[model samples]
Structures are given as structure tokens and as C-alpha cells.
Target: MVKGALLAMGVLGAGMLPAFGPCLAAGLPDTPLDRARVLLVVQELEITLLTHPSATLALEAWCATHHMADRPVVVARKMTLPPADPVPGRVRADLGASATQPIRHRQVQLVCGTHVLSVADNWYVPDRLTAQMNAALDGTDAAFGHVVAPLHFSRDRLEFARLWSPWPGGGQGAGGMITPPAAIVRQRAVLRDTHGRPFSEVVETYTDQTLAFMPAVDADYAH
Candidate 1:
């Protein structure tokens, strides 16, 4: 669990962003103030992810700054056998790869201590990476963003979906406590090299634990 004050990251009283996603209904908080904290933290994190070229580096900063853990975020392999997702024609097009070109698929939990910040799926063209990079990815727990850092990649946002929010429509007449659900947001983006050639496509789902740093809605609001 996250431990520390949110003073370093700050908070918001108003300006709730409307959450949009099919799963929003499943992730709503109880009260208006509870919802406010969720929206505030989610908004800040969304912006944090965009400020850096490498998501791994960006998340490491977030983890440390928020005191989510004693150590920085690390990629934890979520399965014993790698997931076998069927590659689609459109996926190949999105990745700028010809049909039959080799693609590496990895599923991982981006964890800070015991808290999982994001669950990610990466489909990358291994041919574009250095041999050492491929070896590290195949053998170690190095994050996809860090492993390919030498490419000087840029993430091109393709989709930003909010899975939950406490806004104009959700958690309105609430009597429940502020308990955040699992995931708050999801994103799909393509990673491109220095020359702007697409090499990887990823989907990242950020969890409610990102809000774990914030104090309880009732406690903070009471003061």
C-alpha cells in the first residue's frame, strides 16, 4: 500500500474530468469528495505519463515522489508462459510491420513495492532493438520502455480512455466511504524510434492504487 502525504503532488477541489469508458460504472467512488480526489490524482498521473519519453522512467518518478514504495517501479512478469495473442492485420499496420514480421508480446505488472500501478501489454518489433536489448527482455524483468531506451523513442497516443470518475454523472447521492476501485484509466499508444518509425504498440491500464497516496476523503475534507 502507498504510504505518505500527497502534499508533494498536490490536490484539486473542483475541475472534475468526465470519465468515459464502458467500464466506468464498475470503478466509481462513493461520495463527491472521494470522487474529487480520484479525478484529481488521475488527471495528474495522466499528465505525468506524457511528460517523459519513457513510461518506465516517468512511473519511477511518480512512485518515488508519491512514496508508493521504498523502491522504484519494476516490471513484474505476470505469467509463467507468455500470452499468445493473435496478431491482427490492423495491428501490423499500426506497428508499421509487414505481415509475418516478428513481433514480441509481453504482459507485465508495473509494480512499486507490492502496489501495482499499471498492467501493460506490449507488442514490439524485436528486429528494431539491439541484440543486448532483446536478450535482457527475454531473460530479465527489465521494463519494455527501459529496455529499448537506446532507441530514443516517442510515444504517440492513440487512445485515452477513462475507466472511472466521480463527476456529473457518477456517485451522486452517495453514503458510502471513499474506496477506490481497481482501474481508473487506460491508454493505447505506439512507440516510435528517433526517425519516427513505429516499433512497438502498448496498452497500459493504470490502477486505483495510484490514488493510495491521497488521504481518505472524509479525513481530508473534515479539516
Candidate 2:
């Protein structure tokens, strides 16, 4: 129902807001603070997403940097709700699907250790993939990008929406305590193999769990 509610909200873009009393880095002094660590987290996430080709891998880096978890990212095939919107016709056409060709839908949460960093909705052409690739996708919890890596796929971006940006909001908070959203950013793209054939279309919704960690802060960083 929660996913349904999000979908019914017209277009699912980015985030929701909550207080930051519990997210502060341990042993950091903030007496003279003019900014919040959450601000830094947002900026870091933005730049990482912009520069990285694979959000799944980029998030693995983030998890390692933040020490949020000790393991590589994994996909949890836990999203049971049908996508709020039907696969757009344009997506089918992009994958070169004929009227009779079959397209498959998959949705899963990308989890790192304990936190769910993001949820992804994917529509892919089964015929474009190898039998092993399709089987791995259907049976394993492996991230889509990882499973399809053998194809040497590259992302073809369609759009990016930064639903919550600290700079845009001035990073101002009540008493300098910011409340960040559950979702911070979203992206839509297609995956093209080495031959430049589109095989999958994905829509990813990044959650605040991406910001769930104590960033490495130098002693003088806040000064």
C-alpha cells in the first residue's frame, strides 16, 4: 500500500522529510555550527550519482566509505506491488520490441548490509539477453547491473530528478537541525550492450538510507 500511495502521487520523483537528531556523527562538536552533516551527505550523494555509471556500484562505494555495512550490495526481491504505471510504449519501442515479443518486469530493493538504499523498477527484453542471464535475473537476488555485466552494458540516461537538494533549500533547518526526505533522488535510463542495442529500461528511486551513515569528518572539517 505504501508503494501504491507513492505511485498514486502522480509521478514518483524523490523524497520525504524527517528530523536528524539520530544521524549525527559520533564525537563531533557542533557548538559553532553553521551547517549540518546531512548537508554534506546530500552533496556527496549527488556528486556520486552524477559521476558514476552504475548506481548499484556507486552505492556500494558509498556504503564502504560510510562504513554503513561490511558487505557488497545485494538485491532483495521484496517488492511485491505492481508498478504504479504501466510500461510506457516508448520504452518498448526503444528495446525494439515487436507487438508479439515479450517484455518482463522486475522490481527490487537494493540493500547494503541492513539499509535499503534504493528501489528499482525494470522492464527488459528477454530475447535480448542470454538464457543464463534471464535465469539469473529470475532466480537470484543479484543486482540487475551485476547480472547483466557480461553484456558490457552502458547506461543511456533519460532523466534525473533531484527531489531534495540541500543547496537548493539553503540547507536551513530549525535550530540548524535538518529533516531529510525518505527519498532524495530518482533516475530513469536504458541499458545498452556493447553492440549498442538497448536491452533494459530502469527507473530507480533512491532513498534516504543512501544518507544513512556517519561520513568521515576531519576534526577541522566543521571549522
Model number with the top TM-score: 2
Task: At residue 75, give the lDDT of candidate 2.
Answer: 57
Report clash pairs, candidate 1.
none
199: Cα error in model 1, Å: 1.0
Off by over 4 Å in 1: 1-29, 78-84, 169-175, 216-223
Error of 1 at 68 (Å): 0.8
Superposition error at 35 for model 1 (Å): 2.2
Clash counts for all predictions: 0, 2
Q: lDDT by residue for model 1 over 173-214, one digit each (tens)?
A: 344545445667777789999999998887777776666666
Query: What's the TM for model 2?
Result: 0.79
